[model samples]
Target: MTGTQPFVLAEQALLGALLLEPSRIDSVRPHLRPHHMYRPAHAALYRALLDRPPDPGLTMADRTMALVRDAGAHAAGITPVYAHTLMAACPRPRHALVYARMIVEAADHRLVREHAVRLGQVAAADHARDGLADTLTHHRHLHRVLDDLHRRRPDHDTATSTPAVPTPELNPEPPLPGNLDDEQALIGALILDPAPMSALSRWLTPADFADTAHATLYRCVHALVLRGEPVDSLTLAWEAQHQGAFAAGDGGLTPELVAHIATSGMPADVDYRARRVLRAYVLRTAASAAAAVGTHAGDPTLSTSRLVTAARTALTPLDDALARRHNAITATKAPFTHTPPTTTATPWCTGVATWPTTGPDPTNPTAAHGPRSGRRP
Candidate 1:
């Protein structure tokens, strides 16, 4: 069959199964498990649909696949395979196998062909599973023993083109001068943009990210924060509105260590937007945890889901308010304080960026809400 054909067929097959009983997902689970003859992208799309606002006419299976496509998921068959592989890496690979099988069987040869490329691309030494022969298999296991390995590998720094090291006394290049709100508006974009779209997109949105400066700042902070480095103390030779704590020498955590802790199972691309969103989420999550700690003495509140819920509840109102204000200013091209600077000495330092800070922000109208959160702001 053709490429789209298998998607339709697989979608229909799952829909039929779902019609009998939404809870009967496992009944068809056998067809999707790992090592199955024909592996489809673990009908991950279908399973992902279970967690959304109700949509009529379509069964959970159809909606799940639809969501996948909307997010630019390609190679209907490969989708299942990737899902399976991901699950294999999960603490429990069983569910990944089931979902993968369903999508595979539903797909046709065309999907299989295209998807083969991706499977090969990611199936490198690092992603492959390892264990039996060598106690530490797979890159993940190797990572568990990274410090030991680094100690053994010959030190051959490629001094010709090496990235600069961040230090404690560093003062990052100053960002373009701008008013607090506009700079923050830029920060708001950075803090909210999701680096990768997945099932989790339905849960929350970051509240504060604004622009590229925020994005850079966020990446620097996240890279440092994940390493357990102090955000409030570090100093770096970088400058961006989100760079406050990061430049301070407290990149919160180191990059390698941070990657290990952010188990969201997706990468936070070091892009201006993605990093910004990550920074906001990480910071706010930390803030919430801190707040929870403080309030624990007063009342027992701010459970993970509740705090996340509160953020979700406030997202719409906050976004709408920001949009109206931004549009009104732009409609007249009003002389605003947040406008970017016209000249720059270097792309990284002066090209209309914001220098991050931890001080009081008057424009932080919805500081109460974070996109990934579920509590009330």
Candidate 2:
């Protein structure tokens, strides 16, 4: 049989079990809705089972026939012979609840997969529009779907192995040539004048760079800035070598290229270029998160709780970048102030508090209903 045929057989077994022992319908009734069945005819029959009760006076065979006859009115293909076949197909009528659970599990996977598809599509659209709003919306919706699935399968076993990393779908649109330029420009600007590193470091991370070599270079620059060390071509190259950014045969970060990055770009445009880099990172991270969620949904081994946990973990990077982006924007608008000398240290150091110091801000309307969530403002 094909992969999906087992679910069809599961629907058949469930219906047969219910027909054979109508009193046991109550066992599956609360959790297994008729619409959860894979086949339309099975769904119709299940609905009929719920609507019509077996005659109190009828024998076992007669009751089965009566149930089939009633269901035939609602479902086109259900006949007495089909009913007999279903009855025979069931391995044991006592295991009806197990069959019902199987059907529900398949239904949950289908629902999660469908939602993942929509999320991937939304992520693609948001990338095209250069918007984070829809990405956040679809992510929250997928989380809700996972939450509902968890409610449906509270006793699900979560001891499955870690889900393999999914091979992400290639984004149809190649990064604009200017995207790499923006990354280079941002680094160049920082190299030319390291002062902006204070403001830019609050949001831009090395991972934001499209090119690995550039990311390595950015990391070196950021490290030097934090250390209050001089940042010129020679010092930057030394930092790259110390961090092992250079692979022997790759000819990574040639001296001429380092000088080019150090000399070019206007320092004043660091914020603009940094925003562009952050934007690219958000879109890239969203696409990756969507793919991972889709893959998690498709894994049969994953229990509902595991699926939700895996999906949330996959989204953490994207969530952090978006939060930082929002905070960066907020920080820009607020007047810059000197860092106060405090006995207590905060997780992040910007002129303003990027994250909540005590707890989630109840006053912030967009804050997630949790303990100091990294939600967008």
Candidate 3:
């Protein structure tokens, strides 16, 4: 709550600045709106500013009083006098955009924080229930909420004039249940000791992470490992900051989080941890593919063959992984050698003579020739 106090001041300043200089509303309008303000009174004032005519002939004070009166702010316990107080308190009208931006950022933070709290509640409930089906459902809902919160909003200026476009719904399948503690332990271990990077890289990558912050952190760590650079808390934090991963006001890669992960679990079984991460990723992908197939299976436009093909493609990753493992095992086994027979066998032959026949054997005295005699000829 204390952190949000500045946004309250910013909202006041923005409304005040706009009221003092109505012309500046155009610049602030693209970045903010009435709902962006934390306080309802400030929000109402912003709406008033936006509702005013472009060339109102009335003085600013008179316009504010008329708007407040029309809005029945008196009955709502807000008055025109408060409006005048805000207008007089604005330090500079030129900084309206800055104040508007602050309000917008605060609104975004509020949304994220509210959703996070709800997510925590749902997760706790699901844990208490301890049902696999319920857990999966809760996780899917959480993913949807996370996706919505992180999805980029269209620019206010262009969004007003542009035609609405439909976007395909994202896959509804939730990621497979994973041991995040194990994942964190592996990553922390890798950072604590880069010697395992080469071995672990074969089984896991940054994309294997289900959490965005962890993914970003892992990517930084992967980069450092590839470059032969040290990867500890300090280096990881520096890299994350440099990459702007922590610029957004959400959970991000930080030294404290890293240290906590490092100490949370044993880092010695990193190879096994990497396998678990990879397995979770594979299962998640498979589930997504299955869900996609199920969704598209009933569509009249799609052929059964296409659905089958898609299903197969979706399930191919596991098959490929298994195949690779089999090949690796085959490669490590002993080579086979063939041995020749000790003795040669008789050659195969048809029962026929290889001599030319000239009607009959003329030199033989008792020789019967041609078709009349079935002799040696």
Candidate 4:
């Protein structure tokens, strides 16, 4: 409700910050200070030099001079760019970020949406996992709330497609995970589900893989692949992820793989370098398969291009995206991490836990041990 709350909300830490201290907004003032703009010439001149890259040698006077030059075009035109510039140079990092965000929020409605789009873009040069996570988290929650509202009552008279819900289920668990080889093994299972994949609608139950979530996730992914439904794997992955079922011990690669399969139509949310490598590999593997098949028959529709294209085309773009995403993940880190951060919510923290001594060992009933320390919860 306060001026600073929007930035807090935009940052996804608003609730947590509010819980910590109700006046977190007071901290944001330095960065988001606004230009008065009533003095158009001075404001326009100031903004022009601020928006573009500044020469290190340029004094404030020189910068102002540049601003004066640009304003021949009426620098303080009140256009989206002008507003964007004003906010971007708020003279404080935090305040500037807030103003930039506010500009984007406002631009979302007007003809100059490009201004908003550019403001929101996470450039490869600027992308920090932390910042991306922060920004995306806020937008994601907003999207979730709006979607819930939209679904309550559809406009039956309208011809547009239903709001893009991204998935069918809420709080879907992630696939069980494993190492890279484990991922491959899980894929193999889907191709050959020993229990018969068709029985998912009737027999598959969460409890079946209670002790081995990774296996359960694989089975679930196999089921979706079998159905060949049109949906996003990432969305389904969220279900598993939200339930803390994504990591290896929880559920593992299976849910992630499943998410990849479901999201065949989109890019794999992977970092570009990692994705390219995967795309190249997929292309190469597909080419090799086509070449081998040509030996068996007079090229029975098995050109290298056609084969690779067919394989990629067979699944939605999201499949390649998942592969690409997995590639991104593995590029920097190991195939499987020890545990996800959320796993700490459990009572146990150590991997090799020792059992409590059973009443000082029954065999030595009188073996007195002095003042034992209590086990802290």
Give the number of the best model, judged by TM-score: 2
Clashing pairs in 3: none
Query: Residues 107-208, candidate 4, lDDT per residue (tens digit)?
Result: 222211222123234211123221233323332332343344234322333225322212111221222222233333333443332122222212222222
State the lDDT at 4 in candidate 1.
Answer: 44
lDDT of each: 0.32, 0.71, 0.55, 0.33
lDDT of 3 by residue, 1-377 (tens): 34547778788787788778888988987768777777877777677678775567888768777767754552363577877777876889899887877676666555433443443344344434432344244334534533453454433334344332212244533443445655677777667655555434444556667776777777666554444344567667766776677776235656677666656635466555766565555445434433443344333332223333343444354445434433434533534222211112112112212332233333221231123232231
The per-prediction CA RMSD against the true structure, in angstroms, equals 25.0, 10.5, 25.5, 23.7
- Of the candidates numbered 2 and 4, which has the greater lDDT value? 2
Error (Å) of candidate 4 at residue 293 is: 44
The clash count for each model shown is 66, 0, 0, 25
Indicate the TM-score of model 3.
Answer: 0.39
Error of 3 at 77 (Å): 4.0
What are the per-residue Cα lDDT tens digits for candidate 1 across 1-377?
A: 33544334344444334432345445544444222223233333444434333467776457544555633352354343333333333332223333344344333222222232222232222112311112112212322222332343233345453343211121222222322233343323323422211111212222333333333444443332222222221121222224453344343434332233322223233232333333333222322322222232122222222222232332333234334333433433433232221122222233233333333221232331223222112
Which rank order by lDDT, best down to worst?
Answer: 2, 3, 4, 1
List where candidate 4 sits over 4 angstroms from the true fold.
Answer: 1-132, 138-186, 189-377
- TM-scores vs. true structure, each candidate: 0.16, 0.77, 0.39, 0.18
User: What's model 4's lDDT at 303?
Assistant: 24
Best by lDDT: 2
